[model samples]
Target chain A: MMRRYLVGLILIGLAFALFPLLRQAGVAEAPGPLASAYLENSADDFGAANVVTAIVVSYRGFDTLGEVAVLFAATAGVGTLLTRRRLGKAVPPPGRQGGTEVLETASRLLAGLLIMFGAYIFIHGHLTPGGGFQGGVVVAVALLLGLLAKPDAQVSHRVMTTLESLSGAVYVGLGLLGIVLAGGFLDPRALPLGVVGQLFSAGSIPLIYSMIGLKVGAELSGIIDALKGDRS
Target chain B: MMLEIAIIVAGVLMVGIAIATILTRSLLVSVIMSGGVSLLASLVFLLMGAPDVAMTEAVIGSGLTTVVFLYALSRAKQPDDEDAAALASPPGDDTDGGQP
Candidate 1:
């Protein structure tokens, strides 16, 4: 216990020491190529209203691709950890399920609204602060509500796998298309940047975000499904 | 400035909750408190201006993970209450076998 307490204090001290460093990074204005070029060609080249989205989906698209793979790996990990036969035997019996009926009914009404909002966030990612990741998670929350209210609810693995695989393939194919057309990967300009700041602008960004939304939604649903399936 | 302070406080809360979860005897309480740790960490990320990470943590760490932990906890057996009851009675108090 003493050792653990000492470590905790050390961590708190380190956090305080690093606070200034993080603040400096956020506030400092450096007239460097990275910053200027980012500001200069982002919206003009990508036609994205959100500069950060432009950078993520275009300037460093490959990194974003890797990030998606990481999420996939995490989803796979938890599934394997809890579901693998090698770990241990299944739970003896399923758990009971009952919550306030009013909350359940409220969740039912809210689920649709959440799904719609998620789709909107996914579609308008290039034009707004939200993006595929946020939107996809929102969709996942809706499915979670079903699991809570109905213990017997089961998500179709076939449908989830199909959605996950197809969305990932499409995202990669779009990137490859950018390489073919623009002589480099993830060049939004390769797909004819529509009028700047418009909803349909940002070429393939909206398309990519839509695919990401689909993929993340499917992946999270699969995870939740697997967790619920192991209730027995 | 306030946001930074909030982040610091949240980080402290998270570490405290993590310690509490580890030290707690009851599995159910540990799982619930761990969820609190995740929620605090997500809020800290949000206060630090990384809304994307905040969203992921909020969804996965606090939401899905907590439910999964609760399910797993229910599957585990409690230390036998019968042992405690046995300890309550003295071993030499077997009057039924005194005649034998």
Candidate 2:
């Protein structure tokens, strides 16, 4: 207890000491160089009204690929760690008797809306605040709710793994197409840059983000399944 | 001024929750309180105008993590219960406090 208190106090003091430094950092009222550049060039170059989507899917596309790879590796690692042999007897299955009727009905009712919302978020990512990662997580939450409502319900491993691999392959293929047809890899300009502020205007950005959303959603659902030990 | 006060209050509440999480004996309670801390921190993030990050933190940190912790806790308790059952059953079988 004493050590914890001491550590807490030290952390508080460190935070206080850093506060002034943060304030003195001369926070910019406008976007930084990279942000400003993206903002200026997004419409002309990528035909995306949302500068953030342009940056994420085109300007810094390689970084996003790396992020996806990291997530994939983490999911694989968790799957290995929680293998049935390592876990011994399965952890007695959650909600063995099934959740209450109210829970089941509510989740069933909400699941479709949640999925639609997630789709909307990722589909309109190039024009909205959300993107692949955020929308993917929302989709995962919907699946999680289904799991909670019906523990015995099985999410087909084959389907999830297939979706994961297929999305990843398509994402890579899109990048290669960019190299062949456009300036460089993951170039949104590979396709026709339609009118700005339209759904299909961002060339391949929305497509790529949609693929990313599917890939992320599949990977996260796989991880949840592995953790839940629902090999059946 | 009102926003500043709100931020300060949230910060204080987060700190208090952190302390409470550390001090709590019940692992489940601690997990829940840590979720509370995430909730408060996300509020602060929203106040600071990072709605994206705030949403992520609230959903992933406070929501999913808490559920995961509870699942893990339930799994962990089983082994201890089995160990206790094994210990108790042997004593009853021995009938004389295992003096045989």
Candidate 3:
């Protein structure tokens, strides 16, 4: 065990030592377009308070869509794995059913607050540090709390699927519109730029992020529901 | 220079935690230590100027992965020393010579 520990430590130490050397080697005389554009054009063009959101929505919109799909697939996979069929013929586990008033009340309060906060984040994504992904995750966290605190609470699976699918379709449709109307897939300039610093500014960026937020939230909630709903 | 120091510290901590996790017999301790490894990796990614990757690592790697692991562990049955009797039993045998 001691020898294994020493070996692991040595390997990690070497990697740590080498990272700086790698950084130095990679530092070029001219700045790459990615780094320069990230610094210069992210906020101005996208009208997003967070540069990260701008990148996710505009620069890598397709990748973000794929990510949402992956999350949905994972949720479905987990749901399939944990269902009654996999557990085989057996007496059901006791004490896994029923709901308590205390838990229900707590979940109600927390879930409501989280949903509100998530909506706020989604709406203000263009003007704030939060965006669709972050807000959507927050919404999912709320749903998870509901699953934990209220055993009897059932997430409407159909509703979740519909919402997720609809949001994704809308996002893609908007992207296609941009490609058709403008020259690029996710060109913010495709839509009318309302005002520079206003909530409505940055044409397609806000719409894309809003769709993302909704899709993410719905997918995550669906995952949590599928994982925890078996016993209840 | 500051980033370098931070990376070194995170790396050392990650290594130490990994060692502790491997040496420990307790599944619970190992899970927590594995979280430390991911957290350190997230910090390293942040230092390397990839905030997007760092955010993903911190959230999914440390947060969701740990919860999922602990939940699975909680669902599993604990093994005890019924060793020889169980192993020596015939393939078709259903009985173990132990009291319930």
**Largest lDDT belongs to which candidate?**
2
> What is the lDDT, from 0 to 100, of the residue A104 in candidate 2?
95
lDDT of each: 0.77, 0.82, 0.73
In model 1, state the lDDT of residue A218. Answer: 85
Q: Could you give candidate 2's per-residue lDDT for residues A108-218 as a string of tens digits?
A: 889889988888989998887777887888888888889989887889888889989999999999999999999999998889999998887888998899899999988
Q: Which stretches of candidate 1 lie over 4 Å from their true place?
A: A1-33, A80-108, A230-232, B1-23, B75-100
User: Runs in model 2 with CA error above 4 Å?
Assistant: A1-20, A91-96, A100-106, B1-5, B78-100
lDDT, candidate 1, B13-89, per-residue tens: 88998999878777777777888998998898888766767777887788777886765544333332323333443
Clashes of each: 0, 0, 0
User: Which wins on DockQ, candidate 2 or candidate 3?
Assistant: 2
Please give the DockQ score of every candidate, comma-separated.
0.15, 0.16, 0.13
* Candidate 3 Cα outliers beyond 4 Å, as residue runs: A1-31, A88-92, A96-100, A229-232, B1-8, B39-58, B75-100
Residue clash pairs of candidate 1 = none
Question: Lowest summed-lDDT stretch of 10 residues in model 3 chain B?
Answer: B91-100
Query: Which whole-number lDDT from 0 to 100 does residue A173 have in model 3?
Result: 90
Chain A TM-score per model, please list them. Answer: 0.82, 0.89, 0.80
TM-score for each predicted model, relative to the true structure:
0.73, 0.83, 0.75
